[model samples]
Target: MPSIQKPLTKRAWVRLPSGRRLNLLDPTPFDFEADDLALGAARTVRWGGHSVWEWPLSVAQHSLTVLAIGEAEAPRPLTAAQKLAFLLHDASECLGVCFDPISPLKPFLGEGYRQLDQALQTAVHRRFGLPADLPPAWKKPIKTADKRAAAAEAIFVAGWSLAECREALGIRAAPLSADPLTPIYGGLPWEPWPARIAAERFGAALAGLAGSMP
Candidate 1:
């Protein structure tokens, strides 16, 4: 009789601060907690820990910035769901245990990472009562706002030149009055907030948006 062999299982789990383990490769349906998002995002650094700020800018702060930009740049007022979607646009990044620039990794990692990323994003959307996919009309403004936010982040926090950042992000140079280094959106300055404060503010914003649901 030949010896029977069992295949080895690859580990693809990330443990949350809440002690919950998520299998990133094949995540099971799980409830998304606002606390987990707030805390995790607050700790996740933007620019892959390469920011020029005194402390790394947290994803929580980045989310608030994007939401603010989306609201300010939208042609009309956005509904609660739209606002939530904007805030959570990068929520999937918080679920990952490490940071890898997606653009650079895509060619090597291929579609598998993208599928996992989308699954995490859909999970986040469902958790907050948003549709898994945003309508086409809404996506444009959100994406534009997101790019503007990225342009500002690159210039201010990541120490990139204005021309270079704009070119890389495909955004127009900021107006003289709207200095890229000192950009303001939604009447809020683009400065990095403390991690704890960012987490608290994110939770508050999430609560307000969730409460507004009919």
Candidate 2:
């Protein structure tokens, strides 16, 4: 008689740099750490590493840029939570597999991914002590700032023509002089920072913002 062979089970969890494991298949409550966020985000490249720069832009830089833009555009001083929200807008992207923007892929990937993304986003927000759903008043400005960063990224790093980027992203590139934050666009022509520096800067920014929270 032939013996029955045992089937192998696949591992569904991912271990982060900080030694914490996240189960991708099952949503569970896990403590969020700034170090893990910084490390993961620093290593995740934007534009799916399709940028024309010598080094691919990391999501860490993108997050920082968005925060800067939001800070500059706020009519009055922003709260600590609002600043943290901007800095963490892409924190879920640190998960690596779900980093792609959903707009272009939504039709093909359908609503499943969108739902998953939102779930992850809510978790991230909760981890940082923010409301599960961002208030619309804050959400709008952050999204606008994010789009402006996207337009700048498309033009400077991805090497897309202004018209092409504008049409694709549905956002007009703000004039470089329109805001102090706009200078980040000019710096895009330079090579991206190394992962270590990106991580450090992200961590530092988070610390600074947390200290300033009122």
Kindly report which residue stretches of model 1 are placed more than 4 angstroms away from their true locations once superposed. Answer: 1-3, 8-11, 28-31, 96-102, 167-189
lDDT of 1 by residue, 121-171 (tens): 887887778888989987887777767776777777778888876677555
CA shift of 182, model 1, Å? 9.9
User: In terms of lDDT, which candidate is strongest?
Assistant: 2
Worst 10 residues of 2 by lDDT: 175-184
Candidate 2 deviant stretches above 4 angstroms: 1-11, 28-31, 96-98, 173-190, 211-214
lDDT of each: 0.74, 0.74
RMSD from true fold, candidate 2: 3.7
Give the Cα-based TM-score of candidate 1 against the true structure. Answer: 0.83
Q: Residue 84 in model 1: shift from native, Å?
A: 0.3
